[model samples]
Target: MKRSRELQEELDSDSETAGTQPTIRPVFKVTQLDSAIDDELDSFAMRCNLPPHREALAFKTYDEYEVHYNKSHTNRCLECRKNFPSEHLLNVHIEECHDPLVTVKREKGEHTYSCFVEGCERKCMTHQKRRMHLIDKHMYPKNFFFAVTRDGIDGLSAPRESPRG
Candidate 1:
């Protein structure tokens, strides 16, 4: 009842402020103290369906020591076959225990690049090889040029002779 009176006073003050700021009042009415108490009691009842003061329900033959021992002993390193002091130790063991052959068997192939020239089909295993291919097969000196000549029924065009001797 006291809480309800206090809440009513608060609502009245809020309504007074709502005249100047029409949006100040809450969209819904606040819960009455009696209903709030009832709701709390219902939630408490649901939570305490089991006895509040009683010890936790036990298994038919609960053995906590065996459970702990099994948990502590079962989590061990496969390679070392020894119980690790903690998960960090187990991770370290796994990282250190990898077989050399496994590393070799999982090796990745060397990096390679395709020639950047338009029609070139050469593949090189490194940048240096690709550069050499470009210089040897694609690049040309500035003076390099094909000479055009007039053909007079010859098999292939010969350089045009200097006009008249």
Candidate 2:
């Protein structure tokens, strides 16, 4: 898509490039990871709980649910029945208060890292294991990360034709 001036202005304001490179805007590629997350959240059951009689509401992203929760719930879990003061407390509870009985490796450099998809307890000691989990366990397309991460070879990277031709 052609870059618009309004988009350029928005990007320029937020990016470190500022006026350095006025034409560049990083493009994001949606992958199975995003789809998986969205699919799980497509039927968010907690949103409609604000009004006792209201029907359940669906959210495409966690941020949307968080916004609704911050405004309406004050403190609640997206997938849990328990109520809390806010996400800050929830995060604190996990980071500081949670018992050592649970094993969720959040550090990237750690020997083991939690799965990319939520609700998946499997941890990975290597990048290949993580990729295998996504592919084997989740049945994600083998090429899902093809262009995004350049993980596998495909016809995506076309050879540039000679200008003379």
Candidate 3:
């Protein structure tokens, strides 16, 4: 979509070529769009009672949320009924303590990961294995990542995406 004249002018004003003709382009760049989405997500989280201390934090990329979630929230593990010293400690406990059974291989600078579903420890060590695992087990959007660390299966990339059942 085209940017409004005033917004375009404002953006052009910040450029090094101040006197040169401004190049009018789409108002929202990919990074800007991503930031907007993250803002919306933060708003949603806030409405859902995200703690006050976390409200001011900014998540730059969606994947960072995975890392953040893994690092934060160290209270009692609701699933395993385990208590931790702190929420952050509890989060670490969960990631380190639980074994998702997945494996990861680094070969020729490429990464090969696995799908360690219960009763089906299928290793995605090859192309065919990866496809079969995605189709037969995780039939979600193709863009989604399992977010399962090599052996630890306790963390999630997104709140909606759960560990293999």
- Judging by TM-score against the true structure, name the best candidate: 3
List, in order, the clash count of every candidate structure. Answer: 0, 0, 3
Please give the lDDT score for candidate 1. 0.42
Q: What lDDT tens digits, residue by residue, belong to model 1 across residues 21-89?
A: 423334457766698877655543222112222543332223653453443454455554554434433
What does candidate 3's lDDT look like per residue over 102-133, in tens digits? 22123432334344343445545554556567
Per-candidate TM vs. native?
0.20, 0.24, 0.26
Error of 2 at 22 (Å): 63
lDDT of each: 0.42, 0.49, 0.47
TM-score comparison, 1 vs 3, better candidate: 3
- Give stretches of model 1 more than 4 Å off: 1-63, 99-165
- Model 1: worst 10 consecutive residues (lDDT sum): 145-154
Quote the lDDT for 2 in model 3: 69
Deviation (Å) of 119 in candidate 2: 0.7
- After the best TM-score superposition of candidate 2, give how far the Cα of residue 124 lies from its true spot, in angstroms: 0.7
| Candidate number with greatest lDDT | 2
Report how far off residue 51 is in candidate 3 (Å).
12
